[model samples]
Target: MNNFKPYYAVIFTSTQATDIKGYLVMAEKMENLAKQQKGYLGMDSARNEVGITISYWESLEAIKNWKANTAHLFAQQKGREQWYNWYNVRICKVEREYEFTLE
Candidate 1:
């Protein structure tokens, strides 16, 4: 992963029906598309009764680019129309962060 003094984290929380309906395809597309974005850092997602995805980017501009992406826009519309019962998006600047890993 790239290191930076400052960056952004986009947290997406969603409650979805078990019905799902094309969600897997769309979700995969979103992840792959996000990586292709200019300021993308990385992302992780998990699904249970609810789903959460935390994506990182270099700047607000990069985040905006991902949000405004045509395919992503379509998915958003579809989410509103059929996929998600409810969802929330929050963006925060990371002032500091640390992690530890053992291998």
Candidate 2:
């Protein structure tokens, strides 16, 4: 789904702590829960020494709702307490996009 119109992107960038117990499980759970939320468009993520996750939504209100979700709040706390060494979140409006693919 190529969404070209205006939308919201929640960009989460982080560096993980060494002892990442249950981190992957919680990450997966959060992704699954995000899929069930209203206005959720899509998500992309990758991790190496640093991790980046960008979730797309239809509106700012949608993003705010996701941020305030109870389960996500727990995950945020866990990330601060144990999982992440440091993290940053940026919410932006995507006004336009372009892509190319070979298949």
Model 2 Cα shift for residue 49 (angstroms): 0.7
lDDT, each prediction: 0.91, 0.95
Tens-digit lDDT string for candidate 2 (37-97)? 9999999999999899999999999998999999999999999999999999999998988
Structural similarity to truth (TM-score) of each candidate:
0.91, 0.95
Q: Count the backbone clashes (under 3 Å) in each candidate.
A: 0, 0
Q: Model 2, which residues run further than 4 Å from truth?
A: 1-3
Evaluate model 2: give its TM-score.
0.95
Error of model 2, residue 67, in angstroms:
0.5
| Model 1 clashing residue pairs (backbone) | none
Please give, for residues 1-103, the per-residue lDDT of candidate 1 as tens digits: 7564888999999999657789999999899989999999999899888899999999999998898999999999999988889899999998888899998
Range of the 10 consecutive residues with the lowest summed lDDT in candidate 2: 1-10
